[model samples]
Target: MGLLIGVGVLVLIALYFIGIYNSLVRARNEARNGWSQIDVQLKRRHDLIPNLVETVKGYAAHEKETLEAVIQARSAAVGAKTPGEAGKAEGMLGMALGNLFALSERYPDLKANENFLSLQEELSATENRIGFARQAYNDAATIYNNKREVFPANLISGGFEKAELFEIEIAAEREVPKVEF
Candidate 1:
């Protein structure tokens, strides 16, 4: 009777460990999926940059520096490896875009151009999607990080390191350029 009870307890412990391990695995996958979501948005933004730059080029022909800055920022964002690096690059891109939009205020024709307006709308929509994705990624990261650190989960998740916290890519200016005004 005593041997049977001891074996049952051991079996329960094994099952508990297995359950926690699975939970950790799920959380990690969620975080990864969230990162991929952010990646998609970033890629969309990158693809749109050249078109945006081209549209502005005709109107702001003299603003070579601003256009070059946008291009450089986009390149950096594309090459960024980690979340921290990506955040900084993304912020730089945001600043460059803000400058690009400011030029629109200087050129009424550019703002009124249908092609420019449509591109701006698409960029705006993508930015909104990126924001949503960031929120989701951060949420997933939070859950994963918490699970990794939590007592029982931590024991089971010992093999898996804690996931890094997701950074919110807020531009320094904190506001998207109101280029239309």
Candidate 2:
């Protein structure tokens, strides 16, 4: 009877550790997947920016400063290495793009151009997708962070090096700027 009880206790402990490790792994993967979702939308936006800029250039050749600003911002965004950096770069790019579009408003003919209109619609939709993806990333990160740091999970996570937090978010100041336009 004593040996059976000891064996049962060992099994329970083993199962507990395994469950904790598995949860940590699942949480970490969820966060990674969430970040990938953001990456996809960001890449889509990046791919569209050049076309959008070119379309605008055709209509507003004299707006060199605005166009240059947009190009610079896009370049910065592409060069960003981390999620935090990317967020800030994307915000700057958004502001520059907004300026470009606002300038486009001055040219009634540019606004009337069917190609420009189409690109604008697509860009707007992509922006919405980015917002959704960002939300998902934040949620996943929160879950993983909580699990890895919380008491019971941390016992196993710390011992096994189960999961590590990802550095994808920064302070509000560094986050993506709201698109007011």
Candidate 3:
């Protein structure tokens, strides 16, 4: 009777560990999927940039520096391999795009052009999607990190490494400037 009781307790412990391990795996996969959603949106944004640049180029040929900066930022963003690298590159690209739009104000015709306006709108929507995806990714990462740090799970989580959040390091850029009319 003593041996049977010990075996039953051991089985329960094994099942508990398995359950925790599975939960961790699911959380990690959710985080990865969230990042993938961001990647899809980013790629869409990248694909639209060349068209945007070309449209602006037709009107603002003299703005070589701004156009080149946008192109270079786009390239860096597309080449980014990790989440941290991608976030930084994406921030730079956002700044470059902002400069390009600000320059567009000088060209009334470019602003009026239907193709340019359509592309700009599409890019804006994609940026929104990217924001949502980043939030989801961070949420997933937080859940996994918490699970890994919590009591019983922490004891078993030694075999698993903590997942990294898709964090943007560009604090200054993320802030909105106070614009008082």
Give, for candidate 3, the lowest lDDT window spanning 10 residues: 172-181
Tell me the spans in candidate 1 whose CA falls farther than 4 Å from its real position: 81-84, 167-170, 173-181
**1 versus 2: better TM-score goes to:** 1
Best by TM-score: 1
The lDDT of each candidate is 0.83, 0.78, 0.81
Q: How large is the C-alpha RMSD of every model relative to the true structure?
A: 2.4, 3.6, 3.2
User: What's the residue-level lDDT of 41 in candidate 2?
Assistant: 89
Instruction: Give lDDT tens digits, candidate 1, residues 6-51.
Output: 9999999999988888888998899999979978988998999999
After TM-score superposition, the amount by which residue 25's alpha carbon in candidate 3 deviates from its true location, in angstroms, is 1.0
Q: Report the lDDT of model 2 for residue 25.
A: 87
TM-score, candidate number 3: 0.83
lDDT of 2 by residue, 1-181 (tens): 9999999999999998789889888888898899789789888988988998898888888889999988998999999998668878887888787787768768899899999888888887887777778788878888888888888777767643433344554233122223324
Clashing pairs in 1: none
Question: Could you estimate the TM-score for every candidate?
Answer: 0.85, 0.82, 0.83
TM-score order, best first, reads 1, 3, 2
User: What C-alpha lDDT, on a 0 to 100 scale, does residue 114 get in candidate 2?
Assistant: 94
Cα deviation in Å at residue 14, candidate 2?
0.6
User: How far in Å is the alpha carbon of 117 misplaced in model 3?
Assistant: 1.5
Q: Model 3 has how many clashing residue pairs? A: 0
How many residue pairs collide in each prediction?
0, 0, 0
